[model samples]
Target: VGKIPWWKEAVFYQVYPASFKDTNNDGWGDIPGLIAKIDYLHDLGVDCVWLSPMFESPQKDMGYDISDYQAVYSRYGTLSDVDNLIAACHARGMKLILDLVVNHTSDQHPWFQESRSSKTNPKRDWYMWKPARYDADGNRMPPTNWRSYFAGPTWTWDELTQEYYLHLYDTSQPDLNWENEECRKAIYNEAMRFWLDRGVDGFRIDTVNKYSKRTDFPDAPVTMPGETDQPAAEMWCNGPRIHEFIREMNEQVLAPYNAVSVGELSNTPLPSQVLPYVSAAAKELDMVFEFSTIRLGTGGPFHGKYLYREFPLSELKAYVATWQQWLEGTDGWHTVFCENHDNGRAVSRFGDDSTVELWEASAKTIALWQATLTGTIFLYQGQEIGMVNMPKEWPIEQEYKDVESLNFYGEAKASGDAERIRKTEKGLKILARDHSRIPMQWDASPNAGFTSAGVMPWMRVHDGFKDLNVEKQEGDDESVLRFYKKILKMRKEYSGLFVHGAFRPVLQEDETLFVYVKDDQGSEESGVQVNKRRKALVAMNFSGQPASLQEHDLDVAATLGCKHGEELLLVTTLKKNDFSRMEAGVLKPWESRVYLNF
Candidate 1:
């Protein structure tokens, strides 16, 4: 806790480039657009900017499929624009991190092109290439029964080589062979260093856990009915040499430049499995974004996220407690977030987004929840303004431009399962990556001020922008935007508590409320002690109805020095936690309050 790293002390903002802004009226956001907003982000107290992938790509997977790691996607801008952005952020004292998709490359990339041209090409071994297997009738099939993350068989057949290439994601994005020493050296010595040398502060590594795939390539056992390909996350995630590969990456590029790296890990659902990656002693990643938190409302296997599941408040409490308590005494770190480019908005998903009045309170409450957590918090663009999901009535072609969303609808319609297709539509309404991809609502202007009205955006802007854009909240102090600013400053002011405190979840079994203690009055050798009274308590009501937090056996009054009463630091609702309510032990509906444990 002493002399913490800058990343641990700072807040991060994730800018989904395509939807951020459009200066050239190209119907797309470019580096210049982001450059225009550097001051806005810096003013929000953002210390790091985690930009989603903008590498040269075919845009099949929305830029995740990189054709050239060193080159910028022409639609975004040239390398010079990127250099300008780095300089702009640096001028404002902010760090910028690019999304590194080394797990796969676009099929059009020169390396993949040469590898697929003929089996004997020198780079053929750079990617995973396996011979096709035949079934009882001698019909050519993929190497295994595994499915790609974007749907369909994991292996795609190439006519040029008459062989199947492995792709854990889209068919156009081929998985790199990390086990190949030459390939590893090439990525480390070329693609990665290119950015670091160009002055980017660091990288947000994509699908980091999939790098070291198991060589056996066993057919995954069918886990769900009416499924075409078996789910293979168990075989492809956390492979034997994942640590070695990551460690090599860290030693090669990360440590040399002292760059920050936050890995996007897949299928690593436990804190234990993730510890090896971010634990300082391990010398791997600085932190990681685990998928378990986002998987809360997702349906079971096969239908995957297309079918909705009821999200229980207690389960969310469990996820928070598990990750927080698990990493308490360790040096490992994980990023805390509710919304991202690949997930739904936090206010709509976890907060009360049914009405604008309720949305602000609940959105601030969710922010309160994360602000109190031990790890660093990342704010997705437009989240600060309490942006909700796209209305369900928006047509797919108009608003849902994500490849995953399009694929689900296409597959559902082709299956002829009327009920299944109906459910897919309904599920997508509740949650889809497209919900997060909606254009940023900067103002009430045409196209939400993201792009000019004369131009057609690749995806439609959410109609709710008329009421929920950043410009609307910028001047309103009670707005979600303002609340975020207040909480961020408080987080910095009390860094000893929020940043370096020992996390203690109180009322763990209470489904209606989430209350946790962050005690800074402790030592490394001995855990948390209530000496000198430097503890802070965060309490939230996770429902529409009002609730009271009964002091439990966890003993908030005793852990904190009781005589000092309470110092209300932050609250979601307008009315402060009055003494009458404190005495009555009631927290307003969707109310969140952080108090110094006096």
Candidate 2:
């Protein structure tokens, strides 16, 4: 067995640039603001920072629509600011991974500008373009029935060239034509090389699975209700040539620079479907982000992402266990995260946010579970302080700025159905991306210390910052921030076990308790027996009610390789009084515990 890669043992922290911090009183987070927080991230125990896109853009989709891949958006700062940020992070012994949105570019990009100028333009082949399909009455129809991820038609008509372009997201983001060899080379040289050569560590590739498309441009099959006229992702997601393209990219760009790449794989229905993208032998991506676990509690496939519903504890366990089992012996790896820029705060979704005690316990429980898992842990901004969902009472018109949320609101209102509009409002409260876009809560200042008092933040700050801000939580021993640091440190202390241990789910059928153990029984490498063995058990209660398990339920005597009395209580969510109850085989609501055998 070879040594594991640094990324596999590292912890990742994701920063939504606009929401992280604001300096110069610009009311938006910039490169300088992030530089000021390098020490803060270092203190949080994260090994790498995954920054969202900061490239030049029209801000149509909050910087996902890039107009110039090589330049930093003015809202973020000048290119010099980015250079300083990279140096600052490296000085603190931390890596920085920039978000790479290569699947598409803003319509305002120079390539798209010339491509749309005329049918015979030299850059016309740089983007995905197709002749319009005309109806009986000569009205224009799209080339396919594919629907954008946001909503509506995937193809936008252009009168100049009498053609339509494919955009899987907001229309302003035009899909790039990977089929053109020149386009691919040019993109690699200009977009990827520019950053890699500048000393940035790696990239978190955005919408990587959408890079390839079926050359024939066939219509997609409708798979869901109310999706008859929408674009089916099955036709293009992880398309036929995706693996080939990624492998080529690795050979050309990533491997030479020793940079890591994690692809954002959307619509990947199974673990096997993602293996080739991340498998070490495939030489494609270093890892891939699959959302099966994240979508577990979001009503599955039929209910849509925005519809809110409670997921069963059993289902959550099954989802996590399945992925753990599938990738156990494979070279493929996983990216463990409870929340990101695209979803609501995990504390609000997976944990109870109704009260302070429940919120803190639930937050710590989920954080501990993720940290102990056999994968790279990803922590989103403000997650350490236990951020919750945006208040439901705020009017959408005033608070919501995400393009997807605004589009959904417009469609719901136009339907003139009050009940449907009400449902949309509820869905936005629970699942809107804006829920995670609120400014970082630094303190109890007028703007929560995210910016100057008079300069308004781009998005409304969550009102609960008075108690949940970083300043208040930094010194408190029981704060969620402290718990996160403790667990992160544990990962570092037990890297061999946590990073390379074999995972086995215990108490598999338990409805309320999610328990799993990591075992490193040692292995033979290079024809020599290496004696490095360890065992650790992680147990978490998923419900908001007390639960109990008998000694037989844990089988500690047999699995620990020692007497039951020899087990060490490494960490737990319980306090002094709760520990008394725990000793009697009772676990408080949302409690988590990790035990080690030495």
What lDDT tens digits, residue by residue, belong to model 1 across residues 315-387?
A: 8888878877777667787778888988788888888788776887898898788787777888899888888
* Model 1 bad stretches (over 4 Å): 522-532, 550-559, 564-572, 575-584
TM-score of 1: 0.95
Candidate number with greatest TM-score: 2
Candidate 2 structure lDDT: 0.84
**Model 1 poorest ten-residue lDDT run:** 522-531
How does model 1 fare in lDDT?
0.83
For all candidates, the clash counts are: 0, 2
